[model samples]
Target: MSKEVSEEAEHAPPKDYTDPPPAPLLDVGELRLWSFYRALIAEFVATLLFLYVTIATVIGYKVQSQNDPCGGVGYLGIAWSFGGMIFILVYCTAGISGGHINPAVTFGLFLARKVSLLRALTYMVAQCLGAICGVGIVKGIMKHPYNSLGGGVNEVASGYSKGTALGAEIIGTFILVYTVFSATDPKRKARDSHVPVLAPLPIGFAVFMVHLATIPITGTGINPARSLGPAVIYNNRKAWDDQWIFWVGPFLGALAAAAYHQYILRAAAIKALGSFRSNTRN
Candidate 1:
């Protein structure tokens, strides 16, 4: 009887195998084409919104003096414009593509395994192109000293050194990436945390905080594209020269945040998943 029972168990089909098999791969060329189109449109609209507010703020500040009849918006006002733009964009499109309005955010997501490498590269290219177009539009609209109007064009102010500027960029980017990782962590979701409510708020405030601290130093370009847009049109050599610091600092900070979030904080969860997979295989 024991032998018969064992044979019956071995011969029976697995209970989980009752479901239908997954569909075979199909011709996905059309799907890919449509996806690309949607992504491009989304990027263009988002970038235009961002640059419009940013450049408008800069122009308003530069052209209208403090003593002018209509007082200009000050530096703090400009900072608020940037933060508010980001908050609106994130709330609008975060569901579609995680609202990576900046390339550094895209790179960080790729490092965290939230986005694929190919997607990351594509998103970066899209972001850069959108930024250029956005600034180009601003140039067309503004009649004043176009070079000086767009938030100083990433140039360091009178007293700030290159090292100091770079330090500010690095520190600002580090804080931004750290906040991003914390806000988007899946474990936080598992714990029923209310991240989505203040997701855009925290990110926008992070930008505001960075600018508040670093505007006097390097104009606080935590996003390379933000610097690149105005710099390209303005023919600003200082902005071009210091562009490397913006890219390198933000990327390095993002990498560090991704590593810390994936390996350090989630090591136990990873081990637990490994054990579960091993048991399933057995």
Candidate 2:
């Protein structure tokens, strides 16, 4: 029996992946579904927790460093806080809402036809609201320092020009969204089916690496929701002044990543435009 099973496995044909039709442009029926609302809730809660922890860390770091230059968790710790939260939250929410937690990510996936425009827009709204609430909680709890400190708002650092800051955000978000696509690709999934945890680790690492590289430039606004949250709460002129860079840069980055992943790396354009309509998403 073992010999027969081995022979059967050896002779089995390689599985082929066929493309599923793209997600509907507007899945109105989804609004009535409990699962859809559940997913929205998951995204909202995850983002809320993400912003709360990260912004609090930023505020705490600022307060500490003011008194003692070497004190507090420092920039490294702040990056860890953001990345670690992403890893944990993505792991927790991947099943429910794809664990976007970032509007730029949702936009990229939408461009790749992995998500519908409606779902992407709603997810972005929920994420933004969650972020605002998260930062509000931080302000309410740590009123004095939160106000005095910068409220963790992102902005172009003094030495950098707006163009440079925009460039940084664009590249940083491209790295992040590119990692998301690669990590979640069906090909990777099939090849490494035994190691499911691999997805969030690289995603988290990408965030950490981007933060390390660009934190000094634009305070790293790779996620529009992240930049929006603090800017809205802090209501600072400097933060607001540089706000366009966060949105425009991340969005452009996401678009570039999507086009590159779909048209070039995955050869999606060739497949669909050619004889085959191969699967792009699992």
Candidate closest to the true structure, highest lDDT: 2
Tens digits of per-residue lDDT for model 1, 207-267: 8888888888887788877777777777767678888888887787777777777677755
Q: Which ten residues in a row have the lowest lDDT in candidate 1?
A: 16-25
- Runs with alpha carbons beyond 4 Å of true place in candidate 2: 1-20, 194-196, 276-282
Return the lDDT, model 2, position 3: 46
| Reference-based TM-score, model 1 | 0.80
C-alpha lDDT of all candidate models, in order: 0.73, 0.89
lDDT of 2 by residue, 1-282 (tens): 434444544565775544456898888988899989998999999999999999999999998999799999988999999999999999999999999999999999998889988899999999999999999999999999999988889999998899999999999999999999999888767767778576889999999999999988877779999999999999999998899999999999999999999889977655444323122221
Q: How much is the lDDT of residue 171 in candidate 2?
A: 94
Clashing pairs in 1: none
RMSD, every candidate, angstroms: 8.3, 6.8
- Candidate of highest TM-score: 2
Stretches of model 1 off by over 4 angstroms after superposition: 1-33, 66-70, 148-152, 193-196, 268-282
